[model samples]
Target chain A: MLAAERRDHLLELLARQGKVVAKDVAADLGISEDSVRRDLRDLAAEGLCQRVYGGALPVSPAVADYAARQTVTPDGKRKVASVAAGLVRPGGAVILDGGTTALAVAHALPKELSCTVITHSPTIAAALLDHPRAELFLLGGRVFKHSAVTCGAAAVEAAQNVSADLCLLGVTGVHPEVGLTTGDAEEAAMKRALSARAADTYILASSEKLGTASRFRVLPWEKVSGVITDADAHHPVVEQVKALGVEVLTAS
Target chain B: MLAAERRDHLLELLARQGKVVAKDVAADLGISEDSVRRDLRDLAAEGLCQRVYGGALPVSPAVADYAARQTVTPDGKRKVASVAAGLVRPGGAVILDGGTTALAVAHALPKELSCTVITHSPTIAAALLDHPRAELFLLGGRVFKHSAVTCGAAAVEAAQNVSADLCLLGVTGVHPEVGLTTGDAEEAAMKRALSARAADTYILASSEKLGTASRFRVLPWEKVSGVITDADAHHPVVEQVKALGVEVLTAS
Candidate 1:
């Protein structure tokens, strides 16, 4: 096959399965493992995929800027957000992480419900201004403008000062093996700190984020209470995650 | 003069000057103090002026909603913001309080200059996102949605954790006698705590706020470094505030 045709075939496999293992793709395509590795390397260079040890995972669209992230699988984000928002009990406190998905969770919350929201994102706090009943607490630290959230030693210290009933966390990628991950190291630390302050932490992952892997690891799967996503319930990765006793919630 | 004309004349005096004393207004119009007091009562009931002891002062338009306050005095706010922005030196840290005027100061900052900004207003921090090099710290507390600022004990505690070289404060009223005031009591405490953390504090007062009074007193003239205003330099109230040894800066 032509190199370009092989690359297109590999791209098609990644788009369909969310990840492509070199050995598996090589066996299925009747090509050498070295050729599959070459194709993966070329795809990674083009910013189309994230290359791991033996495979390539889908690059999360959540790593983009404020506007770009909003347009990535928006319907799936809304569905996941609605499920996460349902976890908040009236008058209970929740620690909310920063990102486009978390912002959608803020919008999905019920209007009349009175709860306490603790967040490090100024953008989240700004949105909660119109919320009539929720009492908001904003954490102070160095502002990470890319995500519009506070992240630093100060932010972690502030997070320790308060406890919450639940935490709605935003992650760029969620894979059974690679665990939870985000784009920035500081933001990853901030997310971990926020999870430590809450009784239960639920990962908010839109459909596209499932089985993907980003650069920074946030937490081990054992630390999270459940996974919320709009991905297909029958997907093998979702089933694998569920088999580990980590509750998998289908938003749709 | 008829009672209607007398009330109109009183409003005119308020427009010309920033306040009106009953005894003075009565004398100027060949009327009794009771007649001036009656007119003042009617105006106060109509929300046209703030009724103070022995007189009435101009009501601060700042007490209005966010959109309404933005339209109160655009030119005056910009002038004061420019002067306040000048006080921020490169690489210096400053504590910025929340309000429309303070938001303007965020906009007035030079794009190429770098500084550290610690603020309680999410709105202010959001505006600084596009700024190339301002390290932002957002203090956490209960959200005061009316002004988009954090206040109460948590905010005061957060303010004490970090110190700044200067504090650019926002207040609804600035007067020689009333000192500094804002619409909310908790916000007043937060502003006082912020001022204490900074080496010097400058009050950002648009021309319309001069001689006006709000419900809560934030600080005394002795606590502030100076007053930045676009009011006429020769205005008697400005001169009186200056005579008290408090520096009054004319923005225009």
Candidate 2:
């Protein structure tokens, strides 16, 4: 197929699935991964798609723009958020990552359950206001407008000081081969730093993010305690993740 | 129904509907409005609900908690917030105080407008994620969980470094006798410090707060540039505020 044809096909896949992997696209189209990458780069330059580590996701996830990401698979995110919120033990210190999904988790928290929530996302901290029993600690740093979260050195320093029982990390991509990833390098560093301080960490991703990859690698699968998603436990990706020894939780 | 049972029913209504007016509850339950008010007052004392002008809202807003306040008179808050947002000029640096009303102002901001918003409320910063043109700066300090904003020495020091063109201050009470007030002393101090750094400061309060009094004073009338509310421009309270040499803006 012509490069233009391949690009069009990739765009179609992204429109349908919310994400596209270069390797998968290459294999399906009988083309080399290099050719798929080149197509993705062109699409990203045109503001059509965002190029990730081993694939390309919808532009919204690639840029860490919160509002844009909110419209993609919102119900799925809510489900995942519900399951993630269930993972927090009462009275534990929970570290929440910044993203729309994490905001959902914040909303799903039981209003009467007491806990201390530390987060860099202003949105998540605000959502926790409804939980009368939550003690919120907002990490301070440079405000990243795109994601509405704090980043930079100050944020990392603050995360290092927190020793939370759980961390619900929101990421753009969760690939079996490439691991957990996000859009920005600084944000990735901040997430890693937060995970380091937590006793347990779980990635909250809707099924749309399965098999996808982003530019910045946040954590290897081994570091994550589990994967919480909206997909059924019997789903292929869920099975694959469980096969790796990470617990997989699906929201009913 | 017994008094305890009636109070339990009221709490249930507040939980489901977010708010319950005294008159309506009395009519529905075959009781006098005075009796309903007594029940609401009892609930308020027990920290189960917050008593507003003619009704009781969920506990969050009643207790100056950030999340609960979001559901109280949302339409009225939106009206006040729109007028407050209109006061901000393009390209100017604005300081926003932490509160449900200020969060509304952040949401009311035009998507295409370019400005710098410095805030201690992570919720406000997160709301600005929809405004692609605006730059956000989140001040760091001890997080005040009740209001979901940062307070204390660090937040005050950060506010001092910023010279904003305008500051939209949100408070719990706006009284002729007491001026602007809030629930916590540290938060009041933080608001005062933020106002000190701004060229013009406006208080965004709903009409229900017109004659209310809180525990801590934030600013005197002379220090404030204006009062924006959902009340009519010709209301006695508006006249009182205007007589103090402060501009009073009402929603149309």
Candidate 3:
């Protein structure tokens, strides 16, 4: 395979396997380990992969800017997003936050699934623009340019008006004790408010985030009814999450 | 004067002079009162004039949006905005909300004036795009298409990050005990937040907004430091506001 195609294949393998050794990826694709390392570094910079001492792991929790993270684990987020999207029922009201993980979920949604999506993310709103079955209720708030998400009093107030059937929490740090957390305080507040009104909350996170923590706490594991990840994620971490009584789905 | 120019002049006279009786406008323009009323009706549709039982008064705050208000009373808003803009000291950061009144103030800013402008209004940001001397910070959130402004969690969070020398609250309902209010609840929250962080707050409202109230209350009289209105507005309501020690600037 061409170097570019090999790199793509290595990335796909990493996503499918959740992690890949540089030597193995290089040998499998007939490329040098140095090239695999360079590819891993590039993917990490884009927030797609977590590079370890010898290999790369797929991004979890979709917990970064969509533009940056979307390019990171393209195949993995897509597969995970597709599996999560299948759970959404038609004519239901959904609240989508601005996060790469959420965008992946939005992208995976079938065109014919009818629902009302309330979101503060401009990117998600733009994606839903072409969705024939989705009725969009865009919440007004203060705009955060970097994340392309709305947060603050206005966003909180608008969210209070919506009692969503489901709220897809994206790019969050999940811990057994801490629940779900994010990097920003304002985002946490908005997420808390969204969760308060949501009938069911599902967290779309990758296994890499299983033990890590961020600055803002969104919710506890008990609040999240479902957890979705890729097939190749660490078995022990998946088991730990499953012990929390949350239905864990893996993208095959 | 050509018919268009004549109509423009007539509108200007009504705006400046506050109200122009049908007979007087007819006499001034050498047209019948019936013809003048016809013009008044046309202007009212554009939100430029207020048709009364006998004649027409200038379009007041209640009847117009910021865009329409700007077009109807260009000279007055400019004069008021210019005076208000002059209050800005050098090397000071200022917060401006989305409203033509605030837009006028931005327009009236001197080219040599150096300050950082933080705003969530795309319209205001687009307006300042050509101002090379000024530094601009756009607060992000979900875009409000009607106002072209972003408000919510993102905007409020961004606004909370800064402390400004001045906050120019846009036109809305201005009352004694109830203070300032707006038609939009989300906007009201942002306006209130902006007011809280500024060292000084000024309400850029027209004379007619005095004593009126919107559904939402933004600030109390004690919170607002100043009010600016047209010079000709001399109602007892103006005196009532002045009695509270809120410095009132009248634009002649």
Q: Score the docking of each candidate (DockQ).
A: 0.22, 0.18, 0.02
Reported per model, the fraction of native interface contacts reproduced equals 0.61, 0.52, 0.02
> 1 or 2: which has the higher TM-score?
1
lDDT of 3 by residue, A1-252 (tens): 666786678667655544567876778677788888898788889877776666765566223333323333344566677777887888887777777778878877877788877777656766665676676666555555456666788678768767788888785577767778888898898888887788988777765566668988888787788878774545776778888788888875
TM-score, candidate 2, chain B alone: 0.71
- Tell me the TM-score of model 2: 0.61
Question: Which runs of model 2 end up more than 4 angstroms from their true locations?
Answer: A1-83, A141-148, A229-252, B1-80, B140-148, B152-162, B205-212, B229-252
- Where's the lowest-lDDT run of ten residues in candidate 2 chain B? B64-73
Query: Candidates sorted by DockQ, descending order?
Result: 1, 2, 3
lDDT per residue for candidate 1 within B1-252, as digits (tens), equals: 335445656675675456788997775554689988998999999999999998987787333233343456498898899899999999999999899999999978886779999999999999888787888888987889899999988888888899999999999998899899988899999999999999999999898888999999999999999999999899988999999998888988
Q: Report every candidate's CA lDDT.
A: 0.85, 0.82, 0.72
TM score of chain A per candidate: 0.71, 0.70, 0.69
Candidate 1 lDDT score at position A94: 97
Model 1 TM-score relative to the real fold: 0.71
Q: CA lDDT of A57 in candidate 3?
A: 59
| Top-TM-score structure, candidate number | 1
Which CAPRI quality tier does the interface of model 1 achieve?
Answer: incorrect
Query: What is the C-alpha lDDT profile of model 2 across B1-252, one tens digit per residue?
Result: 899899889988877655677877899999999999888888889888777777876765333223233333245787899999999899999999887788888877888999999889887787787788888878876688777789888678767666899999999899987899998999999999989989999999888789888999999898999999988887787888888899888886
TM-score to native of every candidate shown: 0.71, 0.61, 0.42
